[model samples]
Structure formats: structure tokens, C-alpha cells
Target: MSARSGPRRPAGLGATTRAGLKPAIFVTLVSVLAVVVAAIASAPFRSSTNVESLLFQMAPLLLVAAGQATVILIAGIDLSVGSMMSLATVLAASGSAFGNSAVAVVAVVLLVGAIGGLANGLGVLSGVNPLVMTLATMAVFRGVALLVLGQPGGSVPSGLLTPLTNVYGHVPLPFVVALVAIVLLWFATAETRWGRSLYATGADERHAASAGLPVRRTILTAYLVAGLFAALGGLALVARIYSGDPLVGDPFALDSITAALIGGIAVTGGRGSVLAVVPAVLLLSLTDNLLNLFGVFSYWQYVAKGVILIVTLWGYHAAGSPSGLLAMARSGWRARDARAARGTKA
Candidate 1:
């Protein structure tokens, strides 16, 4: 037994430190703080009814974040998610006007989403950078949505909105649906071979391909999954608002990315879990709700959200130096040796 083998100061402290400083933890903490502040500031804000309303408002955002997480996990980003959502909302509303057949509305919405996703897949696989491609598609899709809707508004049938917006026996249906989807996604990423391949490809596409993974196919599938989720979010939005506006999803692109980042999804990819995103979505939604309750200006909300994102990201990088962990480790080792020599001379 050597000094190195002597009793250690238990791993619990390190584990606790890591957990407490995690990005998800920070998001949760900030969220709790915001809620507490909001409750104290406003007497009517502490009720269960308010909580339900907040969850209800967050449903679409949570759905979009779920989809965005998949795309980001694959080392890609989809700027067109918001535009696709807008298109879906318009399509669903139009379909409802024709016959009010829920199936028809759903099919049209999903079809548009799939087509938008296919465009993204083809662009990426064909050598276009994802940022440029999605950015272009974002403009195109938004334009198309504007052309279709010709304006900001269209009504969705009450039959559709009621069930979707219902809190089933005090349980919000949208929240429940989102929860189930998150669980399924968590399992898919954790237990499936495809999930492993996805992470491998995101970490290193060349190496993943050399290892016989179908990199292109995986990326394409990831984008498709993103599109599907965006469509679901769009549908939910229409249901909740009982109308579809051409600009309904304009804010979602930034909000979804912010949520995913806050949730601990690595921008560089291959270092996050879907479970981390749940708290992130809730945190953002709660912030928005509290601000609304206080009658804060919407423009100020956007500015505050942007500031929060920048600060959180800076803190995340500074905390672990994750981006330069290896380099920092080498420098620390050298500094430690220099200190040891100086100590011996003293």
C-alpha cells in the first residue's frame, strides 16, 4: 500500500460538484429562482391553475426542442423548423376549412413537414453546408407559408382544439403527450443501435463511416425526425390558439435552439441526452410565463432571453473548459511541476 492507495476522500464530493454544476442543473436552478421570484412578486401567480397554463403554453416549445435536440445531436442544425411549423399550421387550418376531417388535416400537415425535411436531407447529403441550406430553406418555406395563408390568421375547428388543449382530468393532455414523447425518445437514444450510430457519427463522421456506419442515412433520418416533431408542434399550436397565423412559428427557431442549449445539448454534438432538455424547455417556458404575468414588454422578453442564452453559454464553457479540456489539462500539469520545483527551492 502506497500513499496513492491510502484512503481517498470519497468520490461523493466530486460527483456532487459535477452534478450541481451541470448545465441542466443551472437551468433548473435559474428556473426555480425565476418561479419563486415571480410568485413572490405577484400574488395571483402561485396557483395550480397558473402552473397548468404555463405547461400548456410550453407544449409546442417542448415539442420543437425535442426535434431540435435530435438534429443538434447529429452535429447539425435546422433553421427551417420554425418555417416548417408555420407551413404545417397553415396547411392544417386550410384542411379544416374544407371538411373539418382531423385525419385530412393531420395528413396534409405531416406531408408538408416530410417534404421540407426531404429538402434538407437532400441538401446536406449533396454537399451543402447545413447552415446555409437550412437558412435558405427557412426563407423559402416562410415565403410559401405567407403565400398560402396570405395573412396572419385562420381559424381551426373547435373539435380539434378542445381535445388537444384539454387538461384530461386535471392532467394537461399536451403536457402528457410531450412527456410520453420525451420518454420514447430517451429510450430510442439509449437502448437502440441506431442511437449509438448517431452519436458515433456526430463525434466523427469519417471514423463512423470507416466503422461501417451509414452516416448519410443517419443524418437524413435525424432531419426527418426533426421535421416530424416540428409538425407535431405546429399542430399543437393551432389547436391551442384555435387559429393558424402565417407568422405563428417565427419565434420558435430561436426559442427551440435556446432551449436545447440550455438543456445541455452540446453545440458541437455527441455529448448530451434528451432527458437534459426537459428541464430546459420548462425553464424557458416558465420564464416567459412569469414575464407575461408581470406585463413585461414582449421585445424586452426577447432581449432578456438572448442575454440569458449568452451568459449561460459563457458560464458553461468557463465552468469545465469543455472546449479546451485537453489543452487545459496539459497546461495544468506543467504549472504543477513548476510549482513543485519552486517549493523545493524555498
Candidate 2:
């Protein structure tokens, strides 16, 4: 071998970084495409109100998906978010006299949500499968929410609206919240030791435990975070509609999970980012907004949304897998070689 010949040190990290980025990049492209298509199909989408409306609608889904991604990153799932949100709305609206202080109301709602989430973690730790445990909790929470409201006519304090939904002086409240959630979640997953432990535990529980990582604590933390965010979604709803409705958050269970998956948060666990879910949520919002502008029926929108999710998940598996990435690398190598050979002949 030549004296200077050696394996490139950065090459391995480069390959892994590229591989890790594939899903997020794909989702970003898809989001851009969705926006462009929406703009083209519906001229009204270019209007300021319409554009800002999309941002407002994107916030709740972003929060729920962010929370779900955290739990999924630890190889667990929370099926109770929809119910959690519903319960939050009910609690905030069920005449809980906090004496004109929305802060007090918010604190109580958040606390209850964290408690519910902790219960889910406990149930899982007690040998119950998360699928079953969270599902049961969902039913229980939904029943409690119903009992709290019995219907959808409870009143929410109007003062809470501004903090939750107001776009004042060029700064949208919901957008600010979304940005904060993205930054915090990203930092936790990418820059912190706990984040590393989350991935390790999700990747393989036995290995994570053998390595002396606190796998159970990580999972518990994920659930607590998920619950808190779910309640925040309810708070957003109160700001928007200013009333409690039991059914308001029912679709979030499926929608949030779909957003996380489409956002590049792999359902297989240990491999995805919360940052990706933000744009994924935008894609969904744009799709729905454009469909509405085009006079599409709600039923058709549901079908279209399902199709989009299925296709995105298929793409994730196809282009984000090890074999798929290896194939891409080989293709690049062949092209490079072909270019070099042509140059030599020239």
C-alpha cells in the first residue's frame, strides 16, 4: 500500500448521517410539494389569512405528534392521547371555578394529564402490554370526560383565547409554541444523554439494560411528556372553539400517529426525530386546506389522507432501510466510476 493510503475517517460518519437524514429530507420535500401543489390548485391559498390559518391548525397536531414520537422512540406507544385531550377540555370547561385565573385552570389540567400518563407507565411496568394498557386507559379517560361534560356545551373562559390563539403584532402564539416544542424536543433527542438512552432502550431493551441505562425511567418520562402535550392540545382547542366538546379530539389518536410516522419517526422505534414531525404536520394541514378550497367533501378528505399516509410509510421503508441505503450507495459508486472511466478515455 502507498505510504499515504488510509481509510477515510469521516466517511463512515458521513454515510450514517446521510442515512439518518433520508427520511427527514424526504418529508421536507413532500411538505414543499404539498404547499406548491396547494398553492397552484387553490389560488386562495396564497391569501394571508388562509396561509396563517394553516399555521394555526398545524400546532395541535404538532404537539400531539411530538409527544407520540418521544414515546415511540422508546419502543412504546400511547393510545390515550385523544382521550387525554378530551378530558382536558372537559376539565377546563366543566365549571372548575379557578376565580378568573386561566393559569390555575391550565395547571390543574396539566397535572391531571401527567398523572394519567404516569398511570400508563405504571400499567406497562406491571407487565401489561402498552397496546392493551393504553387502550384501556383511553376508554377510562373518555368515560371520565363524558361524565365531566355529559355533552358538548361547557363554557371556556374567553380570556384564555388570546394566549392560546392570538396572532399579535406579527407573532403568532401557536407558532411560537410550536417552535418551542420543536426546539426542546430536538435538543432532548439529539443533544442529551437521556436522549441517547431513549434511543438505546428503544433499539433494544435488553441491551440497554445490560449497558446500565435506566430504560424504564426513559419510557416513563416519554409517557409523562406525551400526556402533558396531549393536554396542551386540549388547551389549544379551547382557545380556538371556546367550548368543551367530548368529540373534539377523538381523531387525534390516529392523526397524531400518522403525522409522527409521516414525519419520519419510524414506528419501528429508536430511529427518528421530532423535528421531522413539524413539517409532516404542515403537509397534512396543507392537504386538508387545499382539499377544502377545492370543495372536496370531508369523507373524501379522510380517504385521501389515509392514502397519503400509506404511501409515506411505504417510502420510509423503501428509501430509509439499510438495504435501500446500501443500494443507493452502490448506485452512486457505479455512476462515479463511469464518470472517471469516461474522463480517462477522453
Candidate 3:
């Protein structure tokens, strides 16, 4: 009977299975697997304390990733986030000299970050490429932070820092804050019309503009949100370290971008969620913790991280499926056609 019709599989099951294999889900699964492997390999070093420390270490990076993901979502990049964070920390510390007033510290830090983001947004909207604009701002902001706090030394009051740094009955406050931020971001990106417009703009800016979308304003707002989050992250850093160093966020800009990429946030944009970044940050933090436990040198760890970054990025590009499965299907069809032709010729 029609050659048994290939065993007569159910019609919708294949589609459902494919839907379950989304890129975000795949990346998350890989991240979980990596964590399990890390835990096993570093068994001797594993403990509740180490887990807590890993969560603590992931806080700043997660915050930065949360912001950076927004920028990348809009098909833009903010190379200045790290510098902005550093500048904010310095500003907050110096402003703390105003009698440890939390409001004053928060305001100063946010203002600095906002100014930096404004600069980035203006440049980008005015036709300057995001990369160049943010790079220039990175230098400017870092210079300003150095000028403000040359030696990288300022004390944050324990009263202001302790609540943020301490674990509340076995739960890290920063981690909890990060989780809240992720939930908020996920809601913003998924349940809001503005979020859909952001994706539309990133996916096809010309089309979005033609459709009367406020492309410029949307992009500007995205940068502003990123700036605000970076400022918050700077505040968290100050709390954790109990001091505001001028160079506190020197590596975060790159690391955050790396984390975002690893978390399935497509660099080309319009293809990911903020929720995806959590696992990425966790994976990186776990790897670092395991390395430290094994007494691996910092230099070697850096090399390993770089290698992982390259490999993960390659994997993302290879299987992103952003353009749909048509390309893959076409390749398969062409292969089949070639085989058929060979068979006929033979």
C-alpha cells in the first residue's frame, strides 16, 4: 500500500519536536550540561560556599549582560558600558563624600551613565556606526573617571553596601536582584509592544521605518535603558567591593558581550531574549570558579576563555537558524538532486 508510506508517522509531532529545539533552549541545555561537567570535574572543590561564591561572582557580569543584551537586540553595540560603569563607580564614591547619602550617590552615578548613553545614542542616530561611537566614548569616559578618581580608592559606607553584598538567609541579594531584573527584562521584551517594535527594527530597519515605526527614538531609548542598568551594576559592584575603583569595570564590557553572545543573543540582533543570558553568565562564572579551584594560572584561564568564546560563537553562527530552515533544506535538496543525476548518468 504505497510502500507503507514511510511508516505513517503522526503529522504534527515532527513540527512540535522542531519547535522544542529552539536555539535559546539549545544554548541553555548546553550551559546546564557544562555546569554539570564542571561540578563533577571539580568535585573536590565543590561546596555550598563555592556555589555561593560563584553566584556572587556572576552578579556583575549578569547585570552588564542584561544591559548589553538590549543594545544588541536593537542591532547595536555599546563598547562604552564598561567605561561608563567605571565612571559611575568613581562618581558614586566621590559623591559619597557628601555624607554617605545613598540618594546622592545613586543620582550622580545614573547621571554620568545617562550622559554617556546619550552621547552614544546621538552619535548612532546621526549616522555614526555604533562601534566607533562607543569606542570613542569608552576612551572619553575612562579618562574622565581617572581624572575624577586618579588612584582608584574610595570607601563605601557599610550601611549602604552590606545589604547588597550579604546573603539573606542563604540567598544572595545581588543574585535575587539579578533574577528580578531578568524577569523584568523578559517581560519588557516579550509582553510589550515596544519590545516587539525593537525586534522589528533590528530585524529590518528599513522596513520598520517604512511602517512608521519610531526607529530613532526606539534606538535611543534602548541605549538609555542600557545606561541605567549599567549604572545599577556599578552600584552593585561598589557594594560588593566596599570601594569604588576607577578601573573597576575594565574587563566587563568585553566580558558582557561575550556572555551575551554565548547566551544565544545573536550579534546581528532580533533573535534572543534576556532570559538566555542568565545561563551564559552562570556558565562563565562556573568555569572561572572551577579554574580557580584547580589553581590554574590567570593567564591560562584567559586563554581558555578566549578559546571557548571563539568556539561558542562559531557554533552559534553555524546553527542559529535565524534565516529559517530553508537554506538547510535547499542544501539537502541540491545534494539529493546531484545524487539523482549521478545515478542516471551511471
Best by lDDT: 2
Taken over the whole model, the C-alpha lDDT of each candidate is 0.72, 0.74, 0.71
> Each candidate's TM vs. the true structure?
0.81, 0.85, 0.82
How would you encode candidate 1's per-residue C-alpha lDDT over 200-298 as one tens digit per residue? Answer: 555446545766777888889888878888888898787566777788898899888888877766665554666667877877777677777789887
What is the C-alpha lDDT profile of model 2 across 1-346, one tens digit per residue?
A: 1001111112332332244456778778988988887777777998878877777777778888888888877768899999998998888886447665678888888998899889998888888988899999999999999988889978766666557768865445876786797779777776676776776666556555766778789888888988988888877767666778877888898889888877766564656777788888888887788889888887888888888777776676677342222323443534533533343344
What lDDT tens digits, residue by residue, belong to model 3 across residues 1-346? 1111111112322322232135556667777887788778877545778777777778778888888988987779999889888887887777557678767677777777777788888999999999999999889988998998897777665566767678875567878888898779867875576775676565546545665777888899888877877877887777667777888888999998988877666576555677777887877776677778889887887787777666665665567443212223433434533533343344
Q: After aligning candidate 1 to the native by TM-score, how far in Å is the CA of 342 from where it should be?
A: 33
Clashes of 1: 0
Global fold similarity of model 1 (TM-score)? 0.81
List ranges where model 2 is wrong by over 4 Å: 1-20, 169-171, 322-346
Ranking by lDDT: 2, 1, 3
Cα shift from native, residue 266, model 2 (Å): 1.7
For model 3, state the Cα shift of residue 110 in Å.
Answer: 2.4
